[model samples]
Target: MTVLLTVLAGLGLGLSLIVAIGAQNAFVLRQGLRGEHVGLVVAVCAATDVTLIFAGTAGVGVVLERAPVVVDVVRWAGAAFLAGYAVLAARRALHPGALRAGTEGARVPAARVLTAVLALSWLNPHVYLDTVLLLGSVAGSHGGDRWWFALGAALGSITWFTLLGVGARWLRPFFARPAAWRLLDAGVAVVMATLAVLLVLRPV
Candidate 1:
């Protein structure tokens, strides 16, 4: 019973950490609405979480604690990437591309979609701080139950991304119009830019 509670506790904590608006989540929503490359994006997010959770559980978080420079590198890189994506989103807003649903109109190349998600996953310092260091510390403190905690956290990632990626289709009607796409892009642009500025000013 104690173990079950611990796992549930980990699950709740993991969901809390992840259920925020961010670059990765925003991109997932966009792809989900567009009905393109949603599966790959979800898989990338979940897999990245799995790797980080396991690494954190195995005590790699301690190594990260000692190496502040690595965090800084990711910080700057993430900011740059976020800024770049923001620019792209702003451009899309200005142009207002058609939001075709379910394999229609024109398709964004699969490689491009995958690359964007990968960059969003790896380059974000917050991901490392939250998933690797914070979660790792929490799991480690759980001692013997650390693996179960890690598993719960990993499940949180899988569940959230899967639902987010799939559930975004519910917004398909709103996104079907060019005006709606423009508004969405404009919002994404703002979000990415704001996050980039925040990253520069205060990393992690």
Candidate 2:
């Protein structure tokens, strides 16, 4: 059916957008390895993304698209956040021993985890441009059953984050090694810094 094809297309597109080693995914993996509230973090990330995708599909993204100034503000803010996060990640990478000797069994508060996930998910302009404008545009092409397209996109978010969390958990043994953790922290730093530079250099 045409509807089925559209939904599949949306799913594919959504997955492609999210299946990257970016700040969000790196943070989720780090928290998961730390034995933190992995489920809550993944759920919050997925749920927040789904909400934004729905808003975009409902034509809210069009209104946002019309306001260039608002988009500019979000862009600059996201850039700044990414830069700050990059600094923290770089610091961690440079001093992995400090984190290694700390309370590995320590639990982060649910509220803090939720807040971090929400900020990572919602504060990025790429989130809006990808989920809202881009995905919404694709979904809008589905005519009468656009909601199905949105559902498929939402499903993509849920599937990806769930898999990431579970997969990271399975890799806990590998991450337990000090060298491995150091490499991961360094990778996170590089990814975040790259994203931050890209965001800053992006054409407004």
Choose the strongest candidate by lDDT: 1
* CA displacement after TM-score superposition, residue 89 of candidate 2 (Å): 1.4
- lDDT at residue 90 of model 2 (Cα atoms): 73
What is candidate 2's TM-score against the reference?
0.92
Query: How accurate locally is residue 140 in candidate 2, as Cα lDDT from 0 to 100?
Result: 88
**What is the C-alpha local distance difference test score of each model?**
0.88, 0.81
User: Looking at model 2, which ten-residue stretch has the lowest summed lDDT?
Assistant: 97-106
- Candidate closest to the true structure, highest TM-score: 1
Task: Estimate, for each residue in 1-204, the C-alpha lDDT of model 2 and write its tens digit.
Answer: 887877787788889999987889988888877867888988888987899889888998889878988878877777778788778767766775555543263576789778767778877888888898988888888877888899888999999998888777789878767778778877887888888788789744
Clashes in each model (backbone N, CA, C under 3 Å)? 0, 0
What value does the lDDT take at residue 38 in candidate 2?
Answer: 87
As a whole number from 0 to 100, the lDDT of residue 87 in candidate 2 is 81
